[model samples]
Target chain A: MPLSIVYYAKEFFRGEWARKFLAAKTAPLVTPTYFRNYPELTGKTCTHHLFCMMACPAPGAIDVVRTPEGWMPRIHVGHCIRCGLCVEACPNGVLRSGRILESMFYDNTKLSFSFRIDVDTERCMGCGNCAVACPVNKLIDSQMSHGGRASTDDLLLKVNEGKCQVLHVEKCTGCKTCEHHCPNEAIHVARLLEAVHAPEDEL
Target chain B: MTVLQSLKNFVRSKSIHVAYVDVGSCNGCDIEVLACLAPRYDIEQYGIFVHNNPREADVLLVIGAYTPGWEGKLEGLWEKIPDPKVAIAIGNCPISGCLFNRPHTLVDPPVAKHIPIAAQVPGCPPRPTEILSAILSVAPTVFKDYEVRK
Candidate 1:
């Protein structure tokens, strides 16, 4: 069977053993590479400090704090699955795994960036999943009504004639929940300034 | 024989080395394996070492299944590992072609067809402890003399 070809390769060539030897030789190299690339001890300071603040549920209270250093992550320690969703989400290599754990355990105070989502008033559906998922309620109600309790009519959604021909006068919070959650990348948060400026410039 | 003696005996032998290959996997399993190395699971205390090179590995622990772009590379790497080597298919993709499995799929070939698998560890990605157990069971002789000195 063609499937047996793999077994044939393993048995006849002893390829598995060779790979092990090669790995043994290379294991030492990986360490040096990691250190040279990351350089934990040098203590080179980060110029830009962004905090990805998270709110943790206390015994009875919710405690919110900004992460002092590194890439601002959406999740916290007990809550992190190490799935790397936040890591991948980071455009900068601010949020990293592996040895970063060692540094975090040693020094709890490090400067970092906090990612804050600003929604365009014209394009948000006001679904509060992002607010709910936010570990530190950073994405809270910018408006008076809380928990996506804004007037639907007040929220304006814009349609790009070239991009999305279909128009809907839907209620939007400009909270960016729809833009962030839209799997198809079809929805975009419309900037309030851009919409207001367009008609004024035309006049 | 008592479990302690059996454990003792298992540590005395020098067994096989395992190497892992990531072929377009989402890397969920990779993170779990790394976690196993941490203080929590501590698979290293049992004598299993994860290797990078394919030539010296006694066992090939493959994490992902075939994608069209990566098929040839996987085959090439599989050929490089020396034998008497056992292939341990880990994760649902290699065994049953889990999420990425489709008839007209880009990288559709099941891992079993690509190599001669000696054992299978099933899970979306099996827990590291489970992976360690699978490795030990397949190559008991190599691990007979294993001792992890803290």
Candidate 2:
């Protein structure tokens, strides 16, 4: 054991490993460029097209606010899903992140599905059963916890003035719970599957 | 203030022990954390070590939405960690409950109500780099001035 220790000490003192050791210690692994980094503003100015805001799936993720230098899109880091949809939605070269835009042009296809709730007012009796069954409604509005008759303005949908009103359609998870609970069949939740593609696709 | 004490403190700060807890998360954040430990992210390069035990940990990683199943017991879990410890809430679940915050669900979000959070990394499940940065920036502050306090 002592002889082995002496041999290792001699090799260490010879200093072949010192340079490699220093280099390894000084440098660390970097996040890959293809990684979906947060969106950053480029030299191209924002035109307030509001396309980025529409494309963002996460609520409050992207907002076109009037900054001191005019209208610009502000990305809320805490809420952003980093899905890169906002980067693709910008008409001008205002925002860029990773290779999300390049992926759209290549054979890589992006698929997005959205839910649209169509309520037929003619057949509606305003029972609020769908609202009571809605998972989002019961979670957001504590008043709905007991029954759906509560008048809170935060619910996804509620009975107001003898008719069912959809408050926040964006909050729907497309669970179809509301559609299943509606006895009158007035509320119909339709799933819209759309393919994401480049705006100016030649082929 | 002695030389030996300062050296010990420096050595201790250089080596950080991290223990993670999942109160009620969907394991998305846990997957990201696993990536952090992977060779590409390599959190250990910063001298951060991860294990499941909380007693020896200097940093506690809390991931997940506050679920009903963990109710009345999360506070007890918080007490297990030794002092000079920092809790980093990873992903949006713990930050705001994210998608799990919705109806018919048993999630009680904003995990800060139960445990004190030193930092937060927000996303559906944040990138591994974000988790690495969160631990690197926050852990040292709690261990700062170790000998002086003693």
Candidate 3:
């Protein structure tokens, strides 16, 4: 017992174990390079083959929606698991994520995505399809007094001043419910991919 | 409130004990809950502890659709948690059954039909941060009024 104790003590104090212990304590910890990140748009044209949607394991995580630019895959962040399967499944290089797809992108702490609503003033007939179909707007203005009309200004978007105005862009969750409800396809919700921390003033 | 009572309120509001249940989900929401427990989110930093027993839970996180197997079992589980308990629906499944409560699926439409839900974190399976914020926002108000209840 004494011999074993001496050997263990020496190993703990001066052997490889001590070096390992110190290294472990001082090593800079970082997320694995291969760790899956949220899939992002690559600006490549989407064939809309629905491979990404089929491969996504999380429910309501990915969907192919029609935009004026054609069919594009929309990632619902709330439901996304970041499995990277959708990234692997895309036939075209449209959706990108994971170390396999890593390129000379911004090396930053956060890579977030935000959706911005773009109203085609020329195409928008002020029909209020998007305004009426927005779930948050409905919740905020439940008493939508008139048919397809905002009863109050406390809404995410409204058909005010004879045009659909986005009152609060921050309220957009990228669910794209409004995009689907648009009959003339006037309202466009596009995912704004941010690879690095934007300036506070710009935000 | 007395000093002791106020102190209790402070502690109770800051801390929460959550019990998780998976009625019949595809395990997607449960995985997200697991992510909340992991160090990246570290819900313990906010004084949130997760366990399996509803008896010790201040908040009940309901996942998945109300499956047929949990028809009466879910209610029994809810009754196990003491009063001043807040039930949080942690996914779109529990809120509206997402893709489960189809035309004639063997699941209930919404969990609220069986239990009183205090909050609904609506996502197919919500992000861990979203779940954390939901719990942090709801647990305090629900437990603050505990000691004062007649």
Candidate 4:
């Protein structure tokens, strides 16, 4: 049987567990994770130029996964050699090495943390520079009402009135595209680390 | 508290000997770490000493991100440290690879990936004051945990 058929049969018979189990066996020697100390922001500022994805030496190390909100970049730790190329390739400084784990159990959701996107309402002209730069145009356009005519030259972005609002918080991937493209520095994206439940006695 | 327990605490608290290592860094953090022991910072007044040998060290201060070539050396040094040791990553490089998180020279994961990290002080090159305070804050918790395990 072809590999595609084999994969399909496995998925149909065993469901997601077969793949998850396979992922666990090949876990990285050392896990290098990233986190944003700040919490109020959303979505990475990634412009979707995919620079980091290209620079990554490992195949399938960096990929875009579809969330309910939209497509977001995902890091597969099992294949990662702990090379920092993807981090350096990012111009927005969105990715930073955070925790180093001696071992890691397979968890797809735990591979990358989520981000929150916050707009600086005061500084934002609602020019849609972020919208233009965003890889998922439909997600941005669907959320915000277009007030002004779209500009051909992104150099001078103008919004007649009202500002872009992130309708969905969990949808953000923290790619840092909007944060980098904003002329007035209006957008900020931050990662949200899972809160550790400290023991009551420790607290 | 039992007399033996109190005595152990007293002796442990009286002095904190540190071993400093730089894996792959600009040595900016190394200078700042050393400055803490200099007369200007005078950490010795608080019974802190930079012993430079891991066998005598109660605390291991790692100053750089672990490079590909130095993994064995780092592991060897880590093993040489006596038990009840506290490892504090001194700067951003050792904890997060800092600005050198690139692939050209094989600067991959931070030090924590190799050894267990007790605490971390973050900054490209953290201030001497920050390094001093991180050491002070992390030492007690590590010692306490060690005592509990014992």
DockQ scores for all the models shown? 0.06, 0.31, 0.05, 0.01
Cα lDDT of model 4 overall?
0.64
Weakest 10 consecutive residues of candidate 2 chain A by summed lDDT: A20-29
Q: Give the B-chain TM-score of model 2.
A: 0.91
Model 2 has fnat of 0.36
* Residue A148 local lDDT, model 3: 55
- Sorting all predicted structures by lDDT, with the top scorer first, yields 2, 3, 4, 1
**Fraction of true A-B contacts recovered by candidate 4:** 0.00
lDDT string for model 4 (A1-203, tens) is 69999988777678577666533233222322353121111256655545556556555456655667655556653234345555544544445543212112122112334568888899988877776666554443444334433433232223445685665465555577888988899988775544223323333
Error of 4 at A113 (Å): 30
In terms of TM-score, the best-performing candidate is: 2
The digit string of per-residue lDDT tens for model 3 on A1-203 reads 99999988887887578666633232333446565556789899998656676556666778999999998999875456676767766657688776745432233223344669999888888878788888888788877643356667678888876678898898876668889988888899886544444334434
Clashing pairs in 3: none
Q: What is the DockQ of the complex in model 1?
A: 0.06
User: For chain B alone, what TM-score does every candidate structure achieve against the true structure?
Assistant: 0.78, 0.91, 0.94, 0.90
Q: Evaluated with DockQ, which candidate comes out highest?
A: 2
- How would you order the candidates by TM-score, starting with the best? 2, 3, 4, 1
Error of 3 at B89 (Å): 3.6
- Pairs in clash, predicted candidate 2: A135-B103, A139-B103
Off-target runs (Cα >4 Å) in candidate 4 are A1-203, B103-105, B145-150
Q: Over the stretch A1-203, how does candidate 2's per-residue lDDT look in tens digits?
A: 99999998887776667656533253555678988777888857888756677677766678989988988888887677788877775667588899876776585454454678999999888888898889888788756742356757878888888788888888876778889998899999886556655333444
Tell me the native contact fraction for each prediction: 0.00, 0.36, 0.07, 0.00
What i-RMS does each candidate reach, in Å?
12.9, 2.8, 7.3, 16.3
